[model samples]
Target chain A: MIEIFDLEKRYGFTYAIRDINLKIETGEFIGLIGPNGSGKTTLLKLLFGYCRPTHGHIRINGQPPSPKTNSFITFYPEIDSLYGNMRVFRLIDWYSRFFTDWNKETEKKLIEFFNIPLNKYVRQLSKGFRARLKLLLSLSRDADIFLLDEPLSGIDPASRDKIVSAILREYRENQTIIFSTHIVSEAETLFERTIFLMDGSVILDGKSDDLREKYGKSIDTIFREEMYA
Target chain B: MNTMEFERDRPIFLQIKSAVKERIVRREIKKELPTIRGLAVELGVNPNTVARAYRELETEGIIGSRVGKGTWVIPEALQEIRKEMIEDIIDKFLNNLHSIGLDSKEIKEILEGINDRDI
Candidate 1:
């Protein structure tokens, strides 16, 4: 369980996300989304405790978000962070050493299913393959909370669908899955709940179907209206 | 389960209700099988959303409760629910059809054409 009380992240002077109060119960699949530069990354990092909030508090379970809490949380950034020269299997081995929650069996299965070469350096992989590696790294962790930032980015439509499906498979009964993306429609099919972000704040959030039912339009339609329409 | 979920400024309970409805229609839930807290915990959804879904299902007669037995699915689940859904859509379909100045007869013809195509 994560309770964010009046959470505020400051960048110099202006607010990245200000005085926002949200409670995400354990096990819910939440899609944290906002427009570009709308603090989507900021909010996620704040929740993940990567960046300090200038004010307010974020309490996960009972304690503040910290490295101790890191074991229970797994974050998948839109970009890559693995060592390029390291072999894929080696990277998994390194991560498993750092996080005891790493499941070797799951890692092997993902490697086989994705057909990721165990011997090749991660840097040699294509952009799509690299993204898959990031996803694999994130999914392989047996954490209770997942903060996936734009898992669908830079991928083609067919692959995007596959990634979304993979996300569904990764969701466990006792965990929380939070994914952020700009293309709501692409992820709408798997969207149990969605959060619409613009200008660094959550402008809309709800179950995906409820948003469509209330707005009388699909999430994509709503995005068009919110951003440009 | 103390999971924090915001409707993110939108109606959340409604979405939950529909998702539960789908499960109920498929008989994936046997009604009153899992308590609200358990369901919320299992689904990783907010307890409020689970409560709302239960409320709506009860109102629509898809599920019911006994004093101690908790919520249970109705035996005759799918037929009535599907019929209800079709009736629910008919109004919206007709309204959209009316917006284009089409009458019931024309709408029926179009639906028949669609049905024929599927067959």
Candidate 2:
């Protein structure tokens, strides 16, 4: 379980996220959606303990989040951190040394499924392949809460399907996943719930299906209307 | 299952349920239904979503599962599912007809008209 109470992250007298309170149960798949600069990334960073909260508190599993909690929590930052010069298989070996929960079998299966060449350097891979590699690394971990930031930001429709399927395959029954994305229509189907943020505040938070049924529109449509209206 | 199409505006579990109900109606699903996990993987959807659909089907007596034996279509599952789904279809149909400015009398006339046609 994760709880955020009156959470705020500020920079130079301006708030990135403000007055937020939410409780996310275990095994829930949540989508954090908003336009650029809506503090989606800032909120995720606070939960992962990468950034200190300016006010209020966030607790994970009844305890305040800390760096030590990194062991059980896996966070995938939006920025690409993979070394370009390293071969694909070698990077897997390096990641295994840090995460005890790394599943080698899943890594091997994903490699085959994505048809990724182990011998090629990361720099030589295409944008789609790079995206696939990033996802493979994230899903390799057997973590409690998976914080994924923009997993579908840049990629063709074909590769997006593959990446989405890979995510579905790696989902464990006991895990809690919160992923942020602006491309709502493509990924909205997989979300159990969604949190709509605007200008550092939550505008709406509810079950994805309930929101759909209430508005008689897709989540994407609702977001566009709320944001543009 | 892969051949099934899903709409973007509705709940995914409903699409899964409709697909399964269609198979049952066509007699494609016999004594045994596919495991929830297997069908989820095939459809590339969350297993929990498929579980929800299966649970609803079970509640309606269209399908049942044992502890270790797995899920299967119940006897007379077709009639059970059809009886439940047809009412919803008719309700929607009537609501749509009304939306087009048709009253109950016009709807009754359309139903009578349907009886005269092959449809």
Candidate 3:
């Protein structure tokens, strides 16, 4: 469970996001969605303790969202900064050595499931393959809370399907999943609950179905009408 | 214990109503559903939301209320609900396909292809 109270973040002269109060319980597949520069990254960054909130408090399992919280939270950043010079397979081995929860069996299975070549340099892999590699690395951690930022951006249908399927297979019942993406139509399948963020505030946060009924549209359309319009 | 876990894109009141309807459909909760206080505690939501959902379901003839006895499923509601669900599901499906630019002929062809395939 995560409890966020009046969570606020700001830059020197401007506010990124503020007055965010949310409670996420166990076993939630939450979709954190917003436009660019809408504080989605800032919210996620605060969850991982990578960035400090100028004001407010965030607690993961009654404690700060930190390296200690790392045991409970696994994050997949929007960008990949893997050591491009190294062979792809070695990176998995390196992570396995670092995070003890690193499941060798799961990693081995994912390597085959993703069909990622073991011998090629990370830079040599195609864009799709690289994305799968990142997913595999994150899932290998087996944390209870996962914060994924835009895992399906700018990908082909097949690639997107593969990523979605991989997540379905890899997800555990006990974990809480908070996934952020811009793709709206896919929300119906990807998440059961939706959070609407605009200009750094949670304009709409409710069950996906109610939001749809109130506006008589999908979450995407309601968002455009409510916040963007 | 985790209200956020199952939160849908729909309104909170409708979710409460749907939960009661689901239990009725499954026969797990045959008759009068739990009181608002009980459901709110069980699901960890606002009491008012649950009450509102129950009120709406009553108006729809899916459930009934006794002045002092409590609430319950209408005896004939099970059959009526099943009948209602068939048309609603079909309508939503065809409308979705049509909205996506598939014509009636294209939809018929797709349906036929599914039928032709071996189970």
- Compose the digit string of candidate 1's lDDT tens values, residues A1-229: 9988887888898888886778888878787766788888888898788999999999989788899888789998876788998998788788778787888887877777677888899889887778777888889889999988988878876656556656655566588888888876556545667777777667777777577678877677787788775
| Model 3 C-alpha lDDT per residue in residues A81-118, reported as the tens digit of each score | 88888998787788667786888788888888888899
Candidate 2 clash total?
A: 0
**TM-score for chain A, prediction 2:** 0.97
Ranking by DockQ: 2, 3, 1
TM-score of 2: 0.90
TM-score order of candidates, top first: 2, 1, 3
Candidate 3, true inter-chain contacts retained: 0.19
lDDT rank order? 2, 3, 1
Worst-scoring 10-residue span by lDDT in model 3 chain B: B1-10
Output the lDDT of residue A60, model 2: 94
Q: For all the predictions, what are the DockQ values?
A: 0.09, 0.54, 0.11
Off by over 4 Å in 2: B84-119
The lowest-lDDT stretch of 10 consecutive residues in candidate 2 chain A is A63-72
lDDT of 2: 0.87
Question: For this target, which candidate reaches the highest lDDT against the unseen true structure?
Answer: 2
